[model samples]
Target: MSPGYLPFKDALDLPAFFCENCGFWQRHFTRPDSCPLCIDSRHVMPQRGWHFHTVEEARDRYPCHWAEVEPGVWRFFNDPIDGIGSSGYLIQTAAGNLAFEGCGVYSEDALALIATLGGVQVLAASHPHSYGAIWQLQDRFDPELALHPGDLSWSGALCVSWPFDDVLEPLPGLSLHLTAGHFDGHTVLYDRGRHILFCGDCLKFELDPADARRATTISAHKAFVRGIPLTPAELRRYRDVFAALDFTQTWTPFEQAANSGRREALTLIDTMMATRPHAYPVPLETL
Candidate 1:
């Protein structure tokens, strides 16, 4: 613990605690003895050792800021302060704005921008790692923050009120669907009208072959994904899960958007399974 660090007991009532080594906030509950995100190889741990930081210290070190990446959508990023380099977004809709992704950084400028665009009505994270400085945002904005029950332990005290079901329709065209891949609780936000899916890391945009050079590698699927390695049966199940969706494009935690539609997305999944037959073999029934 550092000088500004608040003991986990003190932060038990807060939404999350910052793991200095992991450089991200984990929802606090009983002051976790260790960070779940870091201990898991998916996120990787810090070299030095484990340490904790207060939300205040993180905000002071790295102030939150934003850039409008698309119509009615703002992208937020900060490096030096936000050590994990996670990016979040503010999506404006007819009903209200949705803060997607939690970066443990808040700034007055961000507040002003939200005020100007209409304050966020709901808050969410793509996965455990993006659960940034949510407490700070919640404290300042007072929005209905939604956390998946599967990931609740990570969201320490911040008074998690809204737990999501398998499917949640916060706005008219906006729906959040729980899709397992990276984590059992991983979710994706679907914009029905636009046919755009905010898939976090569960489904990622892959580079287009048209844009690839001779050095470009090709694959059946065109999405970048990371998580616990899946067994062939598990991978096929996941493919079936995503294949049922009716979406034209997918946006991930990273900036790129995969214009490939549901067919392409499914192809990518099948291709991934084929390439790693030993690890992800197709079942005989399906064959």
Candidate 2:
């Protein structure tokens, strides 16, 4: 059953709100006048003002789509994410399915498919921008919600059960790593068995045209639209965590996985540091 407008929290008629600019799905009944993420300089607040969608409006606007990008790895999202941030992921695991991030839109079909795969036992995100319709998922699955306490200030109302700090292996072969630069608690999911790193917002990328799912340029950023570069210490922290990983491929919130290895990952950081400290990303041509 997809979310409809009728059973809203109260008669105030505010229902749940979604920030179309940054994809922050706030489920609480109280309507906060402005989106907290949009107010921050790290994220650009559209001049047109805060664009919000009610549950019913969002479901009608964004259609549901899902695919197994790789074995045991699935991505489900609605189109026109645009600047709303990245899509959510459903990673099938032996312990249980882990739902990382939540699609801002809801679909009955997506919900039913997930049920057959065993409803999500764990739910988490790299940051608040990707915390789409998590409340809907929490309501439906009652999964164990997790968030690094660092981003807890931004996570509204959701009950967090298993919060991970530096590292966590909540499920077999699936791990979470904190590499805070984009935000104080920006994290990445590492699937050890597949040698893939879910980059989250920790890194920015442009997918190659020849190979729609591949990336030729990978860059680091404190904020992409603002063109802010991370401080040396923050970038170093990212390097350290990624160095420990043995991933040959990477995936961002909006883009598909790219054939980038650990060496290319480190070189991007090194190139950024040694030469252009102020440059958003050292530019793919130089890398």
Candidate 3:
């Protein structure tokens, strides 16, 4: 079957290849020879061989459900699932509901919850791996799945591609900044109205999340390591892009979030680059 061809009913049941290396889900009638997203050393390949899992295979063990992460934000997570622990967010906005990422795994409960919170109007991902079960999501919800023009080939289906010159305003007060790094079209959603930055692995947070003082500790090292480290040029460009935004709380696809204000988050990036020196360093010229 061609990509994005699954019917709404069949989509939720279609078999998809879940790449453990990059945490991406691409649905196809037959598995590809190799994971497309992992080809450029963007992700590590499995030593044993390529492994694929169907939605049905995982639903029993890793049930899908939703949780309220913040006042208006809800997180959809799967328990006991293999590969990277992937989570997607649904944020309530005046314009409509916005989802940060997608999970290949879906459930009736999740669909119900999404409907309860005003069905998602737009679903955007930061990178290819974060595309989640985009094909399925499109079939089921028919929401606009935003992708970067540069990463279109990385997509399994025909995605709604956007250009960097034109900013995306999914909602009245929310905007998505398509920055370069992990992928040429990597993005981070910023809610200008509430000062909340939804970073989809663009700005990674490093800390013992289990620690009680994780938020207050400024020593936590947070770098933009999606598949490869950011180049000095890309780092400087991203730094300036973020430097222009004012956000209080920033959240990622993983379990890391920075609540110490945007200034502090920016400072941490500066500190990490200064200390690491090798991977990321202060740039003399901006891109």
Q: Show model 1 residue runs off by greater than 4 Å.
A: 1-17, 26-34, 204-228, 274-287
lDDT tens readout by residue for model 1, 173-255: 87777765566677777777777677766543334456521111112211122234555665675566567678876666554
Q: What digit string (tens of lDDT, one per residue) describes model 3 on residues 186-214?
A: 77888787787777665554455476214
Candidate 1: deviation at residue 224, Å?
9.3
* Deviation from native of the Cα of residue 249 in model 2, angstroms: 0.8
The better-scoring model by lDDT among 1 and 2 is 2
Per-model TM values vs. the true structure: 0.76, 0.90, 0.81
- Specify the highest-lDDT model's number: 2
Model 1 TM-score, 2 decimals: 0.76
TM-score for candidate 3, residues paired by index: 0.81
- Candidate 1 differs from the real structure by a C-alpha RMSD in angstroms, to one decimal, of 7.3
Location of the lowest summed lDDT over 10 successive residues in candidate 2: 1-10
Query: What's model 2's TM-score?
Result: 0.90
